[model samples]
Target: MTGSTNIMIRKLIRSLEKQKKPLWKTVAEKLQTPSRKRWYINLYKIEKYTKPGDIVIVPGKVLGIGNLTHEVTVVALDFSKSAKEKILKAGGKVMSLYDFDKLDLKGKNVRLMKQ
Candidate 1:
């Protein structure tokens, strides 16, 4: 990860420190991992596992390998250009982790997608 990404992770960790949900703690731990060990998920995999209104959090990146069949909110550290376009085309919303953190979702319907 880059220096800015490291800073973002630190901020996210600190913000989630007070949460009681194990899911948030787990997400924080995942974010703390080295970049090489982070996840890279495809759209088809997300589509397969998610419902229309779910929020999917990817700690690494989202790639444009397939299609999304429904509208879901995707939150991640980064997204490939085509991934963003495809998501928007499918009427889904893309969000950065920082913006996602500000929403204070409290882990409701937050799916942590991985490869």
Candidate 2:
């Protein structure tokens, strides 16, 4: 991550700390790791693990190595261009981890998929 991204994630960590959300706090911690060591999840894995309407949070980038057949919400630190397109084409939504802070989630059907 860049210097600015590190700063931003620190702020996010503090925010999640205050909110006391264990799930998002975990995500923030994963985000703090070196970029090279972060998770790289593909569409097929997501499709296999999640059902339609599921919210999947990935701590690293989303790669477009496979196909997705269901509509799901995916939040990640980054996404490949093809990954974004594939997710959208499959009627799914993609979002950045930064954008995740402002989202109001009901906490149901939310998953953390990482290796």
Candidate 3:
């Protein structure tokens, strides 16, 4: 992950911690494993911690596993075929992380930084 993205993830984790939320430890653990897959990250933590209108940043890739009920806009480095289909079908949008430069993150209630 780029330096900025890493900073973002750290910030989100800290926010979760401040809220006494359950997701901080799980996400922190996932971030520690070098070989961990994107599917595991999304299935185990990211989706659980995020909500509709939120922006999710996956520094790596996205995978299809759990269902996403929220109408969030996901920005990732890459996405699996099934994930793309599911996100679109749910009226959510997906884009490359680089595309985030064009978005307004301040407009959202939550932003998930996934590595």
TM-score of 1: 0.83
lDDT winner among the candidates? 2
Candidate order (TM-score): 2, 1, 3
Q: How accurate is candidate 1 locally (lDDT)?
A: 0.82
Q: Candidate 2 at 34: error in angstroms?
A: 1.3
Using all chains and alpha carbons, the TM-scores for the candidates as numbered come to: 0.83, 0.87, 0.59
For candidate 2, write residues 1-115 as lDDT tens digits.
Answer: 4523567767765666566678877886787777678899998899899999999999889999999998999998889999999999999999988777766678588999987
| Tens-digit per-residue lDDT, 1-115, candidate 1 | 4433666678977676657877677777777777788889999899899998888988789999999978999998889999999999999999987675455564457788877
lDDT string for model 3 (1-115, tens) is: 6323456555644543453334344444444345345323353254688777777766557788887776778876568888888888777898865444466645546455654
Local accuracy by lDDT, each model: 0.82, 0.85, 0.60
* Residue 38 displacement in candidate 1 (angstroms): 0.5
Candidate topping TM-score: 2
